[model samples]
Target: MDHTAYIAILSVAFLVLLQHLLGLANRNGKNKSRMRRPPTPPGAIPFLGHLHLIKKPFHATLSRLAERHGPVFFLRLGSRDAVVVTSAALARECFTEHDVAFANRALLPSQRLVTFDGAALGTASYGPHWRDLRRIAVVQLLSARRVGCMSGAVCAEVRAMVRRLHRATTTAGGAVTVELKRRLFELSLSVLMEAIARTKAERPESDADTDMSVEAQEFKQVIDEVFPYVSSVLWDYLPVLRWFDVFGVRNKILAAVSKRDAFLRRLIDAERQRLDDGDHSEKKSMISVLLTLQKLEPEVYTDTMIAAFCSVRDSFVAQAEIDAAVGHSRLINADDLPRLGYLRCIVAETLRLYPAAPLLLPHESSTDCNVGGYDVPRGTALLVNVYAIHRDPAMWEDPGRFLPERFEGGGRAEGLFMAPFGMGRRKCPGEALALQAVGVALGSLIQCFHWGRVGGVEVDMGEGSGLTMPKAVPLEALCSPRAVMQDVLQKL
Candidate 1:
């Protein structure tokens, strides 16, 4: 090589080394001024940082990482910084002490389109707008009194499920293999439809109940297709990819949004027509109630705002209430759910073992805050691993065992953190409605059917990768109508 060329290369290399040294010194100075951050897991690569470590079924992967790191650990995921809380105490601290500081949701390129630009209550930024939506939902829709009024809808849906299952068995002249997840989803959809649009199966065996209606199918398809994209998209994490639409994610998402909006508009327009016709009914469906509110406050309760509630999506997988209090002579109803202790225990245990959302939606810190004695800088994402906390051996005795009896005496054992729906400001507001629906749906199934594992083999409890951690294999079970409830089902 020429002497002059060699010298030029050396000069550039020396300058690069000097800049790297200065960067290190700046970081050291910042560390001295700020409190220590939680320890980070090793093997973080450039650009991606710890993104490579995040495997499918995020909560489980993070739980394993926590075992190796600690209950509270930091992760640099692509461009974002995140803190995972696997311990109850630390999680409680984050919610109670630093609640407001960590109330904002981490901004995502996909959520903007998916949630109508943070208009949906679940993904809305913590502020007056979110507060208003929460209030309207709580007061007019999910309030105790409102949920009670909605009990009839829950009962109607559960009865439809029972009747459908019974017909399936008779078709085969014996217990038939059934997909419980499909049945559960159908029942949930019918109930929600009735609430949102007063739409129900014209007949007990109609497509809406036996099979998902096209509307329900489209709705479910949109959620299953888009939500996972919203939560875990490389486009959201990497600005370069997001800018160029490298993966064409934007087009796919818009297609889903168009389908979803078309569905919501149908529901809204139907209710609007009913109102215009002057058919004032005593039992107003949720959409009807919102339209009523819109008349009072048009600005706050616009069609777009009402559509947001219809699109919450958090309530998509929600249900329970029934048995001893009502007895077999009469069917169990929503009014009976509160007194059914053992049923409540069973529901609690189910949620504990398999929470709907194992990892609660991530929270973002709006400003610098101290969590578990470590400084979490502004914009740091907070993930509370409710799954690990629920199953922690230190927190619960024999946590792995399926023990409904543990929740029987009194209520949850004192101070044990068992948050299936989550905690703090962002706790799922559908808890009241979901618990009632599940109690009735589950109790009705148990009352009207004899269920068993398919082929007498243990169920494969392996979970699939997704937002809700669905079963790897859909639940297949043998079921037949109970002899005692045959007459009652026949009447339906």
Candidate 2:
């Protein structure tokens, strides 16, 4: 080798080494500048941190902590540092101003197992991948037009529920006492499955049907087992415990995820077969749309992504609204949703009181940022306590009381603090479909039946422990066909 070439190579290597050192120094200096973290509660233990302080119905526990530490407080949950935002102002800061910074999801062990390592829409991190999923959801699968097309399926399933209820009442020779949680869950699941896979038989027959396909039954059973444990699992917060499989939490998650993945794969394969059969019908399911997109962009839309795409109650001032607006002349349909303003209010109020996910799905900060004038470090998990914010005395008048009329005059105002379906970029794309389904189902039930509390007792409004924050005691009510809607009920 020539002496000149050797010297040139050495110079290049020296320059690269110098640049690497400089980058490290810069990062170290940045870390040293340590901005003030949010105020943490007083009772953090040594290794457990605030884990010991956490109790069941976590949102309420956090709300009590926020009262002492202020709206935004920090907590060290095992190895992870979490920021809980309990007030509207702080929530807006995290979701609106610092939305992108907090766009990534906290990668819990259970979430990774279920979401295929964050390939699914709800669990994906904040980046091009998440944006792509969101775009596909909003523009293609869950667009207003697409949801409107699927409205028929939603209505049909809701009617099926009503018919089943009617038969139960008739069989009992009057109003029958029935548990509502399972029925409502079945209706919601059926609508979702039909819209995604074009499959109606997947819906559970009676919440205890041995005749159902093993895969279908397993899928439902896995969901029931997995959701309640997502946040409650100790190993997720303390990784070391996973080694021992303490409480068998890790094994349970794995078993449930295995079943779930297998079921989803079957759905995808069936959808692919349908597509291969040259049946390009107009009323395509969400999976079909995703499959078509997968063909064009195979790298971006993988089979796991296709598999991931497949995935409420209210009461009485609603009945008056239905009677006056919809009347008993004919059954309420999707077109009538616009005119049923008060019905919408009731649904909104229900959400405010009981958001599907009380913590609004754990979000992780991508970069150091300020929330409520306090520094939040990168990699800190953010739990926007929408449940706390919704029921904050400062935000809502008589926060515990149900007041659908508060939302009557106008919809949610700009920066007015309501985020039942979440807010900003990561807000749930299924909001429209959810509201529409709930509105239709609730409206139909109220219109067709006169619901009463069993044994003349007020319905137990206690919340259950789970990701979705369901009613602790499943709602059991006396449902009788309304005299006014007898003609409509008879036709069904």
Local distance difference test, per candidate?
Answer: 0.82, 0.82
Off by over 4 Å in 1: 1-33, 201-214, 311-324
lDDT per residue as tens, model 1, 319-339? 122333565665678877777
Steric clashes per prediction: 10, 0
Across 187-273, the per-residue lDDT of candidate 2 in tens digits comes to 777777778787754545653322223443556777887776666677788888878885777777788878787888888888888
Q: TM-scores of the models, in the given order?
A: 0.90, 0.88
TM-score, structure 2 vs. true: 0.88
Give, for candidate 2, the lowest lDDT window spanning 10 residues: 207-216
**lDDT computed for candidate 2:** 0.82
